[model samples]
Structure formats: structure tokens, C-alpha cells
Target chain A: MGTVTGKVLPQPTRDEIRVETVLQALADPVRLRMVAELANSAEPIPCGHFDVEVGKSTVTHHVRTLREAGVIEVRQVGTARASTLRKDDLDARFPGLLTGVLSGVD
Target chain B: MGTVTGKVLPQPTRDEIRVETVLQALADPVRLRMVAELANSAEPIPCGHFDVEVGKSTVTHHVRTLREAGVIEVRQVGTARASTLRKDDLDARFPGLLTGVLSGVD
Candidate 1:
């Protein structure tokens, strides 16, 4: 059971992180809010910190989508998982793209 | 019926446009290809010129999504509807963002 749950986790490759995926991941309002919050944070945020009103299953789905799209990175620390925006990856993939959009989010 | 049909067509306000909507619209593979083709074109392309294998209804839906998200603009010309990338709007909204990612598509 433990191994099965572990196998279900996402492990996205660099090649899979296409611009379309990144865009799609950011398209949802809920996901965008989460991304905005993460962008504004100085440290990695626990997944639970996001106040999205979706069901737990949907929240997991959104997080997985973002993670697979390379918009964010997740790491397990103790019993909690921390997510951080992959600002550097996005910058390298499309220079000034993320920063520019983020500025307009306000 | 004419009024209803016209009203069904989207007329998105500037404020209605959001980054997440744009990102979501481009996330689909077919839409991304369409955007790439539009980006490569110097002028507007007829909606039917896109060879996407999806059903006509689905294609229309995709186009509507792009149009509503402010990624593309549509105009009626004779019997056909033409679509063009809203490059200038995107530029104003997020400077150098589209051009940068487009360069990496190849």
C-alpha cells in the first residue's frame, strides 16, 4: 500500500515541462491564487496553507498539475510536503515571462 | 434567435481577461499549435484553415476559449471567421513573454 501510494506521485521530466503545460497549469483561478501566494512567499509553503475551498481530492489534483507543469516543486519534509514556485526554471525557460505576468496579477 | 446567437458569442471585457485564463487556454496541445501557427502568420487565418482533428464543436470551443482569454481575436470576413493572435495585448499585459517562449518552440 505504501509503495503504491508512492508510485502514484508525479515525477515530471524537463522535456515534459512545455510552455503549454505551464500555461494550462496557471489557467485555473484557484491554481493562480495558489501560485500567487507561493510567489509572494519568501519560503516554501506547506500545501495545507493554501485556503482554496476545493475538496481535498481536487486540491491534490491541482497541486499535481502544477508540479507536473514545472510551475512548482514539491519536497517532502517530515509528514508535510512543501511547495515552492520554480521561478528559476520558468525564468530559464522563458526569460522575464513569470516575473512579468506576476507583476500584473495585482 | 439572431440576438440570442449573437449574445452567445463572447465579448470579453479587458478586466475579464486574466493570466490564468490565458494560460489555461494555451495549455491544450491543439490550441498551442493554433497559436504557434497564428504567431508565425503575418496576417489573420481563417478558422477552417487549422487542421485540428477534433470535432467542429470542439474546435469552436477551443477557439472560443482562446478568444475569451484574450490570446486571440476573431473577426467575420464574408462567410468565414478569421482569427489572429492578440500579440499586442499580450505584450502590453506581459512584456516579452510571448516572444521569449515562442523562440523555444522549435
Candidate 2:
């Protein structure tokens, strides 16, 4: 039996990045760590590289939340998915919000 | 019968303003409205002046959340409390975070 793969979606529209959604996405420690890791990285990171201790499903959910909040951008490279911080979009939407938050985690 | 008023508390410490608490506080529409109003006001506004449509207790809860998030500062004046946006603290903590959020609502 073959497993089905889901399609990779486009980035969320600005209207979709509501305050509630963004807040909810950043509320979790695991997600915050993921975000911080992404911020510190100079290039896109493969989803498989995150050392998150949560279940795979939970990690997927957190990544989806971050993507939906316009905090990260995801792209497909063959079978692997690469995620990059959408620092520009976040800066446009919330100004220095991400920088401050990233600093707080240090 | 005289009402026994609970003492107004001091501001939350810097360590207390976790991402979760701040996100949770700003997640609600009512609280966002209150923060917007405070941001626009040139001076501290009395808590009684908020035109929120929710029940008084609910409004109080929302205000408390904002206060605890370090998004707003509350000072008692006579029998009423005045709430002001803690723009500097927010800015210091999150850089352009508040400005971006405030502009997004416009």
C-alpha cells in the first residue's frame, strides 16, 4: 500500500495573519524554539532538521501555525520541505515584533 | 453596605510577560479594542470609560489580562482606575511590535 502525500500550500495572505492566529502560534515554547532556530539560521532549514522533541504530528501542527501566521515560509525541494523565516512579512505586519520576541528568548 | 475594594496590584515583572500571556491577552477582540483606545488616548483613561459591550466582569477580566501582559498600566485615582498604554515598555521589549499592530488595525 502506498501512502498519500499532501500538497504544499502557498503562503498565507496578509488578511489571514490575524492577531489571534499569530499570538496562538507563538504561545507555545516548542514553536518559539523552532522560530528562534529559523531566525538564527542564514538559510532555509529542512523540516526534518528541527530537533523538536514533540511528536511528529505536533511538530507539523506547530509549523503550520507559524506558516499561517506569516512568520515562516515553506518551500518544497523534491521530497524534503525547506522552511525560512518570513522576516520581511512579519516586519511589515508587526514592525519590530519578531526581533523583540527573538531577543526575549535569548 | 460598603463594597470592599481589592487593592490594585503593581505591574508585572519583565519576566512575567511571557509570549503566551502576551499573546493570550491580545488574542481577544475586546482586549484589542481596549488597547487601541488606550494607544489613541493622549492621557490615561479611567477603566469606567471603556465602551465595551460585554458584561462588566468580562470587561474587567479582559483589562486584567492586558495589564498583566505589560501592555497597559493601571493606576488608581480616587475610586476609579486609569489605564494607559505602556508603549515604551512594549517598544523596548518588542521594538516595532506595537506600532505594527496598531497600524495594522487602521
Candidate 3:
């Protein structure tokens, strides 16, 4: 468990990030789109800023999945949670994976 | 469905391959290992030749999943089934995805 801006958001560490788990998280369409958006962004994106059309709970579920999979990090930013793709850590663990998946996103 | 040495094997075309589905197929450890082995091999490998320690039925299940997801193409080679990674088609569709995943495989 880690805290960001006083809120706790549990996520896997660099070594805990498994390739199978990362792939499983990205296997969902909505989550993949959210990751893609985060990948293209220059800064942490508020959860509401994602382009997914799902309900609030669904969005929360997807975000949690991504964070737990170590594909992204979520932190409390002001009144909302912001997410950023864990590109550096992921690249270090699985070189070329994030870039390839992001580029392959349709 | 297409014929391979007189046996029918079904697979998705280049345009039919989806990133999410491909990721889902590769999400399992067993299936991912099979794919990595295929990536390292220069020729089609017999199904029984894979290094997985699973049962025959389980291996068949995993192989079917990969074949259905368009990750590998299984064909009849003599009395046994031989599998090959669909590298060219996957590369054409998803660019560096297969390479990245295979390289990242532990």
C-alpha cells in the first residue's frame, strides 16, 4: 500500500508486475482505451477525464484493475483520483510491451 | 477455416485479429510459454513437443485458445499436430506486440 496526496492506493511494485497480469488487465477493451488515453497524456489524468463511456462504478473497477496490475498508478489529486501510466517501470520490466500495445490499440 | 496438410484449422485473418483478444489469449502462463517457444523455433513444432508440464487435455485447451485467438496456427503434420507462431500476420497487424511479449516472457 502506498499513499498519494493523503489517499491510499494499493498497487504492485516493479518486481511484482507480472507479464501475464499486465496482459490480462489490457485484455479488456474499456481498460485498454483508458490506458491508451493515459499513455498519450503528458500528465496524470483525472479519472473522469478518461474517454470510456461506462458508468462511474465500472470506471472505478477498471482503474483499480489497471492499478493493481501495475500498468498505471492512481493518486488523489484534489477532489478526484488521477491516473498515470507506469511507463518507466513497465518498460524496465517488459521492454517494448507498453509501446507496442499502445501503438497496437485500435 | 483453412486446410493444413489435409486437416482443417481455423484462425483469424490479419484484419480480423484484435489486440484485446490477442492479449487475452496470451494472458495465461501456459499459453504464453507455448507462444514464446514458437517464437524461438525456426520451424513448426509438434504439439507434444512443447515444454509445458500440463496434461494432454489441458495442453489441447491452451493450444485451441491460442489458435482461436490467432496467436498460433496449428496444422496436421503426419499423425501429430504442429503449431507455428503467426509472426508475419501478427506483426503486420499489431507491429511489435508479439516480439515485445515474447521477449518479455520469463
Candidate 4:
């Protein structure tokens, strides 16, 4: 069966994203870890790769929240969802936020 | 008449602060504006100085939320509650986070 390709999640555009949503999305421990890890890596990571304490579905939920907040972009890569930080967009919107916050985390 | 002094609202110590809570507190527009203002000022400002659109109770609620989240310190200064961002504590915890985030905001 043919599967839908590209972004499976509907997300706010970079311009549409709000500061409150970005901060709220990052407030969750699991989600923050995800973002911190993404901030460290140069390449997009697959969803299954994160070692968050929560369950798989919970991870999916967190990822969706991040995507919707415009902090991260989730692309349908084959059958897997690849996620990456919207660094440029966020930096443009909030300046050095990602770098500053991510620097404190592992 | 004699009144209470120092931290009218119970708050987390500098050490007890958490990243998630900081993000959650800053996620709010009013709270974020308060923080942005505090970031700009060298001196602590009274709670009433904030120009939030909400009512008194609501502003108090937001201030309490920010205080408890460890983003700000509230000290009862001469019966007026003065709030200041825990800049050093937050900077130590999350380097450049406040400056970076605060820079983009007014």
C-alpha cells in the first residue's frame, strides 16, 4: 500500500509560530531532551532513535507537540518520521535561544 | 503597621530551579514581558510597574507563577512586592538563555 510522504504532521508556519508555544513545547522534560539532542546533532534524527524515559506513543505525542510549536520539523522519511530542530527559524524568531538553552543541557 | 518581608510568595531556591519550570514560566506572554523588562533594568521593579492587560488578581497569579518557577525572585520591598529575574542563577543553570531569549523581546 502506498503511504503518504512528506510532513505527516500539520504544523504552524515559521511566521505563524509564537514564542509562548515554543517555550511551552520545550517545558516538558522529555521534549527538552529531544530538542537538546537535536541541537547537538548536525543531521536529522529518526523518531525511534530518542531514548526518552516515556513510552513510544508518549514520545510521538511530545514530538507532535514540538512540531506544532514550530520548534522542530517532522518529515515523513519513508515509513519513519525524521525530526530536526528549526534552528534558523527559531534563532530568527527568538535569536540565540536554542544555543543558549541547549548549552546548559547535555 | 508591620508586615511580612522578603519573598512574599514562596519560591524555589536558586538551586531548586528546574529548566522545564523556567521554560513554562517564560512561555507566558505577560510573564515573559515581565522577564524581558527585568532583564533590561538593573534594579528590581515593583509588580505594579508591569503593564499587563489582565486584572490585579491575574497579574498576581502570573507573578506567583513566575516566582515559583524560579525565573524571578519576589521580595517584599516596603510593602510593595518587587520582582527581579534571577539572572545569575538562570545564567549559571542555562548559559545565555535569558540574554538570548530576552534580546529578541522588547
Candidate 5:
């Protein structure tokens, strides 16, 4: 929720999150890499830090897709948008999912 | 791998399996329901047993998608096709994924 700009981005509550949407968000290569990077980090990252092949609008679309699916949290941080994996919510909804998906990479 | 019929279907080896593809396959409502039913079952189920809104060809397509993603195994049994979730391979590749995804239901 951004008060100054008055732009309220929709976010699903932890209990409202569903596995189907989360799986769809993680199915994409670019989105999954973004999640992998965010998952490994201790801090939330600005969306600009994500390396993707798509153009500006496409990137925004992908991020929105993930955000809407409740796989990640995104909020405006000054001029930049900060994003982080909703690990706790996901783990709570579907236990061991975070570890399961992350373990495939390392 | 099946023999006698000579109808060869493609499948990813356990080591070659990727999370993105598996997630993509599981993202579908029909496919995921099919998987959930199969995952819970101790025995392989005939594809005909699945109740879906799609036509026969469409169901075939969905099953093929899941099979190629290496999330499930499908083999020819007489004239019908038998499908089973590849729980062992998936669990080994992405530790706890089976439990993670399945636990969402119950």
C-alpha cells in the first residue's frame, strides 16, 4: 500500500493464496530465476535487479503475473519497486514447496 | 519404457527433469486434479477413469503434456492407457515437492 502516490496494488492474503496460481507463476523460466534470486537473498530486491530478456512492458507484465499469483510480494519503494518471494505464505499453504522448488537448482 | 506395442512416448529422465516444466504441467486444473488423484492412489489408473470437461483428444493432449514434463508416467495397458504420478523421481529431483504440492489439499 502506497499512501503518497495512492496506488494500491492488489495482493492476495497468505491464506487466500492457491497452489495452482503459484505453480503457474513459477512455471516460467524468467519468473522462476527472479524467484530463485530473491529466495536466496536475505533482503527484498528492486525489480530492476532482475535480468530478463523481455522488454519493459513484458517485464512488468511478468512481475504483475507473479505478484497477482501471490508467489511474491511487490510494493513501490520511492521510485523503485521492491520484490520478495512470499516464502512463508507459500510454505504455510503448501509445506516444503519452497525447499522443493529451490533444491532443483542447487 | 513400454514394449510389444512399439508406440514410444517421450519422457525426461529423472536427472534431466526441470522444475519449470513440472510446474507448468501441474499448473493446469485438469492435470493437477488428475495428478492429485493419482498421487493419492497406490495403483496406476487408466486415463479413461479421469473425469474432465475436455474432449477425448484434448484429454490426450493434457496427459501428453504431463507425461512429457516428467511429472507423470503413462504406459499402454492393453488398448487403454494407464497413468501414474512419478512421485519417486519428482521427490528425488526436487526434495519434498510431492508432499509440498499434495499437502495443499489436505
Candidate 6:
């Protein structure tokens, strides 16, 4: 809604990421897939790049949840928001949590 | 409600344990602490053994959620149901997930 330029959206700082919140975000199957795909990607992926079969608005909601929970970071890239997993930050905070989750992310 | 002897509760089998379900069950602060306490203990703990501040019914609900998610095993111990983390089964199914979550538990 702001300028058309790239905007780094609000996300929880590493220290603000809570275990309960992160787990809550990942509790949904669709969101889990989104995180799994992001983990497999070598680069930031636009919102539509996730393989989830949900509608656009639902995808947006899932993305927002993940962002708010500090599981991922989104940066506006042109007209689309590109999301990147906060792997480094998560690893630093919870050690092997993401890896463990990803291991079971099928 | 069943017999007072030792009625094992209905729970998902090891192969049926889903990542999303596990995350959902652990997403709550009280449940997470319950798991943390169970993880640290050497013996199965009665529902009353957990340090959660919730009332009796709430504690029962949380324990049932964990048991249903296959994160913990509940067995009738005298008049109480003692719960033990399904560590071995969860490890076989999701690898380091429990360890990672436990690492972050408060």
C-alpha cells in the first residue's frame, strides 16, 4: 500500500521470535509446505513461487503468519513480495529446530 | 471414564505422527513446558507432575493433545495417567524434531 518501491515488511527480529509462535506458524500443512519450499530454495522466492495449492488470499495470510512469527522475511521485490526463510536466525536461536522440522516436512 | 486399572489412551501410532500435528500440539506454552518436563524426567510423569499452572481439566486437555499428537505416551499409573514423551517413536519418525523443540523449551 505504500510506495511501489521495495519495502522490507515488518517481521519479528531474531530475538523476538518465540518458540511457541514459530511452532504455531508451522502447525498448518500449507504453511509447512511453504517453509519447506523456501528451505529448499537457494534464493528468495516470490509469494507465488511456493507450491501450495491454496488461493492467493490464503497464501497471503499464510505468508503473513510466517512473517509475523519470524519464520521468514519478506521484502517487496517490484510488485511482488519475495520471502526468505530466516534459517540463520532460527538456527542461532533454537539450534536444530528448523532442520528438525524440515526433516519431517513432507 | 474407562476402567481404573491401566487403560492406555488412544494415540496416533508412530507412523501416523504428522509433523503439523506435532507442531500444533507443541505450539502452546503450557504444552511445551509439559513436554520439556517430560523430556527431562527419567520416569513417566503423572499429569499432576507437570508444573503447568492451569486447572485440572485444562491440564488433562493438554496432556490428551500431546498424547493424540504422538508426542507423548500415556499409561494408567494407579489412579493417575502417567505420560512419557514418545521420544523413541518420534525420533524414528521425525528424527531430531523433539530434540530441537526441547532445546528451545523454556
Which candidate wins on lDDT? 6
Residue A60 local lDDT, model 4: 86
Query: Looking at every candidate separately, what fraction of the true A–B Cα contacts under 8 Å does it contain?
Result: 0.63, 0.60, 0.70, 0.69, 0.81, 0.81
Question: lDDT score of model 2?
Answer: 0.74
Query: What level of docking quality does candidate 4 show?
Result: medium
| DockQ, each predicted model | 0.43, 0.46, 0.61, 0.52, 0.69, 0.64
Model 3 misplaced stretches (Cα beyond 4 Å):
A1-8, B1-8
True contacts kept of 6: 0.81
Residue B81 of model 3 has an lDDT of 89
If both were scored by TM-score, which would come out higher, candidate 1 or candidate 3? 3
Candidate achieving the largest DockQ: 5
The weakest ten consecutive residues by lDDT in model 6 chain A span A1-10
Please give each candidate's TM-score. 0.79, 0.82, 0.85, 0.78, 0.88, 0.88
Model 6 lDDT, full chain set = 0.86
lDDT tens readout by residue for model 4, B1-32:
33325655688777688777788888878888
List candidate 1 segments past 4 Å from native. Answer: A1-10, A13-15, B1-10, B13-15, B104-106
| Residue A99, model 1, lDDT | 74
Encode model 2's per-residue lDDT on A1-106: one tens digit a residue: 1222434558787656666567667767888889999988886777768878988788788878888777787877677777888787777777767776776675
Which residue pairs show collisions in model 5? none
| Candidate 5: CAPRI quality band | medium
Sort the candidates on DockQ, descending order: 5, 6, 3, 4, 2, 1
lDDT pick, better of 2 and 6: 6
Q: Which is superior by TM-score, 3 or 4?
A: 3
Candidate 1, chain B, TM-score (2 decimals): 0.82
Question: Candidate 1, which CAPRI tier?
Answer: acceptable
The chain B TM-scores of all candidates, as shown, are 0.82, 0.84, 0.90, 0.86, 0.86, 0.91
